[model samples]
Target chain A: MRDIVCEILSNKEVGENIFEMVLLADRVDDIQGGQFVNIQLPNKEMLLRRPFCLCDFDEVNKTFTICYAVVGEGTKVLSGLAVGQQLKATLPLGNGFLLSGKYNKIMLIGGGMGSAVLPAIARRNKDVECVCYLGFANKGKVVLEEKLREVCSKVVVATDDGSYGESGFVTNIAKADLDSLGVDAIFCCGPEVMYRAIKKTFADVNIPIFVSLEQRMGCGIGACLVCNCKIEREGKQGYYRVCKDGPVFELKEVVL
Target chain B: MQRRTSIRVERGGIVSNLKVNIAGVEFKNPIITASGTFGFGREFNNFYPLSDLGGICTKGLTLMPRDGNPAPRIAETKSGIINSVGLQNPGIEHYLATDDKWLAEQDTVVIANIAGASLDDYIAMGEKINESNAQMVELNISCPNVKAGGMAFGVLPASVEQVTRAVKNVCKKPVITKLSPNVSCIADNAKAAQNGGADGISLINTLSAMAVNYKTRKPILFNNNGGLSGACVKPVALKMVWDCYNAVDIPIIGLGGITSYTDVLEFMICGARAVQVGTYNFTEPMGASQIAKDLENYVKEQDMDINDLVGSLILNK
Candidate 1:
């Protein structure tokens, strides 16, 4: 990974409490779909860097987009940035999603701001028949639906309040379709509660499931050994670094 | 309106040497990456060459492979971070088989940092590391002794001396005792290491600190308390380094929240032969390299050898 100063080209609100920011950077080469960039906030008071997953990468323009939500003090500062502001970022970190599998029918599931990474996976596998399942709290919380539709073969939007596409949760809505859709692989990124629910729902189904996990980190790199997730190896459990070994792992490989 | 700026030129005659001798081992420079932060010198090597560093203290190793603590092992504070990593490593055999080869080939001193639960464990680990290619072995006494009911050996001067002397007896390489800041009298512990025939001393390891999530009325770290390191611990570390400097004659490697070139000089003036960069490495991958370069510039600008600055601080009498 390389540290470079990226100039903010645009920062705008895409949905409630969410934003899409485009940056002008010189090095955008070899950035994969599920990899993240750790952005150092301008405020000196906030010493730790904030990590955000890659939403899109424009190779020709040497620019990348990150979709973030204003959750805490760090993102609040990030959302307040204007165009032409420079952000020091360490990019292309973590082992991203493996898109080279032999699956023909891929099911991509995203919950809330986790939808930020789904577009890139869909774009990478444009030739494959990709079905996208996006969940939001309501109609106003939906984001990147149009972008996912651009690359995915089918996009299914679900909301808990039923103000948008379906009445129930995305996992509930997709449970019936997963059996009949002939899907060979599944990729999901969402809350821990959602992950547990999805794991229970798909435990009997024998498809290869991949998930992206989020954890509060000190150093986004592997040195600190703080962001650990338990994984099963040969019937024994071991801890793996979410920053290095993954931000992405197979469902069966990780304990949670 | 016209504006003019003045440029300064130099004769470029001064060639300042950054090499330092800690105990009997000589380092090319005085910037060693602290243990637990450098990760066997591979991860940061991707950003810059590891050979350029004076030394690298490998991540804390144990007799057996440890998976470390559970999730939520880290939490952020004012200007520091609290981590309960618990020294997760692949044990000694795995290190000698895999990481030792690469470490031996590097053009810098390699100090193996080892942790243990009992005196026998320390001695075993020390003997194993002594047979390896490492230049020195740092005994991390901050780890809790399971036999002693989880009381860290470094917290008491008697245990510190006992463990150090036990490991020093079998370890052929220079033994540097890494002291913890959790103790009340840090100087006594430094002297205890010296009394036990330690070649050098390195301090201060992270201070025991905690952070609470008020919303849940619970501690953030899984271990409830973790060692804190970063800019916030600099004053405490410098004072301890100074205390140890006056208390013992053995070479001292001072480290804690060291971030800049000035901090390097500060540690030197307080009588540290070398300084290790810790938490700052997370913020900037090449922070040590940059600080080393800047230190050379500072030495040239001051027209003095970097060695002359050691223990040169002026105090009010």
Candidate 2:
């Protein structure tokens, strides 16, 4: 809702190519799960601000954390900064995962680095029983397993190769265990390919499935119309802005 | 050379002014938020008052709602970014219904930036927006993203004149032709628009560029090549603005890579009556208003008219 300066409380690597940065923000009460912050890097020559999801937050301390992989020039420069550095941050962007508390139990599914986004969902809905399923490329790529366990009642992890936890894709395991999940809703954040697979895997299920999407952005608001995705609303297909309209959407409404 | 002024009282009772007139329309200052970046003045209003800037150019509006291009619409390079949004907008009718009333109430001058795939589309948009409260109309003859009739009219001198004339024939507001930098002679196009009764002109639309990933042997943007904008394009824009300033008699609004107060002064010295902050709006949410504030302080400090800086660049022998 506003752009303010944030000081780095902590910045360190959690897993292969993944970094978790904690910042003391001007305010944290406005943020929610599945929403993101657009950060302006320290270098003034770089004209564009980078968007990162709100991996976690402590509203009492006014601190929020973002987990990012070194994907491009922006993150490379970002990863080099030390703790105590100050940077400009725009907080509480995007329509967050509206976790409906009407159900007794809910499922959170994460693929690869997406595990970072699940813990916040569980935190937002502590009144309800929460379960999680995490998928990673291998053991070296695994992250957030211990973090999720602290919040969710049950946590399941799997690797594509047999290098860690249970073997095989997490989507496959979730599909196989669909009968006993006994949950009312499912929320997932992962690659686009995983969404396609989940749509096919959970085709006949009666439960509601929600998904979070990612895209390159400009303005990190609805203005630039850069980070747009196709979605179906009122039986009409159109491009909706991922930064403002949502980073979270119902799987049935998504055109992917 | 002498400059014009509209003076206001300062805190200590001293007089200072940041106002300038372009084609008979007065702007509070020379800092205007460029089209495609500001989005109808609502988002930036969350950071500061919309009236802080001299004016705001709405997102490029078309006749019908455009789906735009697929994802990966933006790609970043050193000091700049390339975007292929393909003129995504909610259509003129949608804007008139939703954002027009809100923008009219914002207490700032609003300029509608319009684009199209055909002459009829441009004419229809021109007539449709006249009923709205916007004070001016900007003809977008140079969007590199909307590939069809956009580039075809932008690159040619004849087509540029025809598009400007067609819109001028129907629209009641002052029409400012926005020229593209990806053309052979941008000055010729400026002159063509003036000949077609354009009130003023703004330049330069982003340069045609691309970012590639050699490992995948593929371009970064889904639409391969896109229009480039940022600090890297400032020098190129300065040259084009100066060239057009000498070639035509109408006022010029300079843009491309403008990020700060110094950049605004430079653009004014190079012959821009006003400047539009585009790529920098993405970097700083309150940037356009900040530039306006800085420019006001500067003019007050110098105790001179801001208009005196326009076209003041001294040439080398």
Question: Candidate 2 on B1-317: residue-level lDDT in tens?
Answer: 32343332333443566788888889999888999998888878889999898999999999898888998899888899999998888898899999999999988889999998888888998999898899999989874324353356788888889889999999999999999898899999999999999999999998989999999999999999899999999999999999999999999999989988999999999999999999898999988888899889998998767787888899998
Worst 10 residues of 2 chain B by lDDT: B2-11
**Regions of candidate 1 where Cα sits further than 4 Å from its true position:** B1-15
What TM-score should be assigned to candidate 2?
0.96
Provide the DockQ value for model 1: 0.68
Ten-residue stretch with the least lDDT total in model 1 chain B:
B1-10
The local distance difference test score of each candidate is: 0.88, 0.88
Alpha carbon lDDT at B119, candidate 2: 84
Q: Per-residue CA lDDT of candidate 1, range A1-256, in tens?
A: 8888899999999999899999998877678878999998887666788989988887789999999999988899999999999988888899987666577888999999998988877666656678999999999999999989888888999999999998789998888798888888999999888889998888788888999988887678787777889989799999888889999998888886
Q: Tell me how candidate 1 scores on lDDT.
A: 0.88
Provide the lDDT at A98 for model 2.
65
Q: TM-score of every model?
A: 0.96, 0.96
Evaluated with DockQ, which candidate comes out highest? Answer: 2
Model 2 CAPRI rating: high
